[model samples]
Target: MKHDRPKISDVARLAGVSTATVSRALSAPERVSEETRAAVQQAVEATGYRLNLAARNLRHRRTGGIVALVPNLANPFFSQILSGIASVLGPAGYNLLIADTRTADAQTLLDYAEPSRADGLIILDGTLPATALQGRVPVVEACEWVPGLPAPRVKIDNRAAAGLAIGHLADLGHRRIGHVAGPRGNVLTEARLSGTAEALAARGLPFPEEHLYPGDFSLDSGREAARIWLDQPAATRPTALFLASDAMACGFIGEVQRHGLRVPGDLSVVGFDDIELVAHISPPLTTIRQPRTEIGRAAAERMLACLKGETREADTVLPVELILRASTGPAPA
Candidate 1:
């Protein structure tokens, strides 16, 4: 005769918790006390209760969980990206797991690849090494990545995006243009830097190395970049700044104000990654509008195809638009 399946009551009895608590610990673990949750989990594992996971997860050749890995979840820009991923996955009856690796460190990135719990991975953070991916999971490179990876990707042309930012500044008659670059050795940094150089060269302009501010894609880095720009001699200082991200641009503007400088008066600014805050902040930001949600959706679709062994294009380049706002104007005469 076939064996009857173990019940929830059996798990509760072993765990010394109410059936309700067991359910809570299993489903919404954040609601349960750590100690009790651990006990319940131990009991569930001890009983070999797969708990419908085999059927629930696609990795088990069934409907499995899919993880959307982001470097930072709190950023408002990524919130829409996550929603886009969910929008694509929810209709297919797939569960979504969101994990913020917290840091861009290689070790943390590699840790996410282990065990292959998810059938596929949508990687928003580009810091992870390609070696870490190595067939462990179906990987779709989203907005960012380390340089020189052959993995399939979905993104806008970073080089052209940077050129657009510089061109906007140049059009404002800002001859001395400064770039607050992203983190050192970052893939975005190289692409944007190259684009800035190409734009300046095409305009018969020269970009001094001193005008490149080292930033790590943070508000603090932007603040630092502003301070460095201010330190330059007034006559020779960059009349305008183009930041690599909206966060950096906000920081730069905030810092400039703290020093009693007005945006678009003392300096004309252009930023990339047209996040929501760019529109609400004082003076509003002039920025490049990235198709962030579209990128997320495209990445998800690519990963799904890879999971299904369906042949698909290796790269998809989304388009970006330039938004001119109050933050930019003619350079101060």
Candidate 2:
């Protein structure tokens, strides 16, 4: 004969508590006392009992799911952030659903935020319109944020980070500096570009329109920028460059080196986002380091708080650091 499956009643009996108490501890854990939760957990382990999430969710009127909206799933920069979110939500009995918003239309994004689909949302795409998310599920913005959304956001100071990059190059006696900017209409692109301008102005450095190269935070764009730079006269070229993303910086460096250029000796380059790949690249990159994992964890915590009716309207800004490497040096004489 087949043995019976372990049930809530078994857990309750083993923990010396009523089935009602066991149910609360397993489903809405915050409602139960710490001691009760611990006892129920021990009992669950002893009896090899597992929670029936479907039945519990139905009874509690919860979807037991959280959705995270990312701009690009293929980018390695988002990997650590997603991992941080999963670490917190997994133990809390919530399933994480990831959606790539890059190609998703407005309706498709709205559907993901529907009450029947997910209980909460973690948004990493700031380009989304505020109207799309108005009056939907509770949301916590991570890394990027929509302007005037009133949602709790966790991110680093993009402008300040940009300043750090420009300052580093300026201090190295590089008089002429150039910038590779992110796409227009992006929040980060605007912030970082403005910061670069401000830093240059503060130092009395010239930044003509020609010095700014358009980029989409992609390697291809960086390679294209490299081509443009190579076409310019050597006497007019900027001695140092600050790129918005590490991928673009690497692309620019690779392409220029192909034409027999040496980094820092011929031109110095700095990048934003100290991705893992940057450290291992040829002539390791100097970049601004963002606490990507911490941003995700903080966003997840804020999302959980919103779901629990402990909502706050505060924005959390994490710190960034300037990481020096072999990619930058004093300007060539």
Candidate 3:
């Protein structure tokens, strides 16, 4: 009842050729004689023989698979990104394997790069170290971490995105603006925070050192950040808050609500990453729209190129946009 998979040996026997000839004809057809190639092709169809990809790749020094590293797989924003990555790699005869690096230790990133298991890697976590990644495998950074390694990457201009947030608030007459930056050491967080400061300075607005709060790019951190912001004197309180993530913004909003305050009425808020629920929330978030799918697709394409040695080290940055919604309004008079 079980039909055995047709093998190269079967094809070689039917084609009246050696197994080496069959291998070369299938993998590197250019090396085989035209007559031998035709015979192998005909036998391949007659016997319904599919090349043993695993064996052939082993012989040819290839894994034929790729690994993706993610910081948090549960985040809805990453779902679209994963879809885009799959769309690109699936058709190219590559299987995607995900490594949730957060669950793994910091040093374990190297262990997952075994060339026998995965030909290359795409890392979404930016906090990883450069030395741990060197010469292990071809790697590409997508959206999050980049260690200035000789690898290709694709991301948004974090500083520019942050500037967009600041400008939006300043235009709405928010003179006392505060920022809830991402985790302390994250490059994205630092870039955005720097951009926020730069935008304020350009507009001649004050960038109070005390107004910046540290967060870990989570909802709970956002809520705690609001408490820190509230503890400041009323006069020094930021009339508007620019949070690094939508979840964070939501946390801030929730905390403010528990304190009997309303968004845009008592405290205006802007968030980064226009996540799925932002529009549906009571006060729709004003935020930056990151091209999540594009980030994934671009990273995949770049990784493929790296595997093929078609491209060297490079940085690819996607654009971002500001989405205005109810969460932000003219600063409270």
Q: Per-residue lDDT tens digits of candidate 1, residues 1-333? A: 998687778889999999899877875587899999889989998876646555435434643667878877877778877878888876555677888877446676665666456677787877766787666767778888645556678888999999998888888888989899998777888889999999998987779999889998788999999999888899988999888989999999999999999988889999989898899999899999998889888878887788778766557899999998999999899
Clashing pairs in 1: 56-63, 57-63, 57-64, 58-63, 58-64, 126-145
Q: Which candidate gets the maximum TM-score versus the true structure? A: 2
Indicate the TM-score of model 2.
Answer: 0.97
Residue-by-residue lDDT tens digits, candidate 2, 149-255? 77899999999999999999999999889999989999999999999999999999999988899999999999999999999889988899999999999999999
For model 3 the local lDDT of residue 237 reads 88
Error of 1 at 239 (Å): 0.6
In candidate 2, what residue range of length 10 has the lowest lDDT sum?
306-315
Model 3 superposed RMSD (Cα): 4.1
Runs in model 2 lying further than 4 Å from the true structure: 28-34
Runs off by more than 4 Å, candidate 1: 1-63, 103-111, 114-116
Greater TM-score among 1 and 2 belongs to 2
With a 3 Å backbone cut-off (N, CA, C), the pairs that clash in candidate 2 are none
Q: After superposition, how far is residue 244 of candidate 1 from its true place, in Å?
A: 0.2
- The positional error of residue 313 in candidate 3, measured at the CA in angstroms, is 3.6
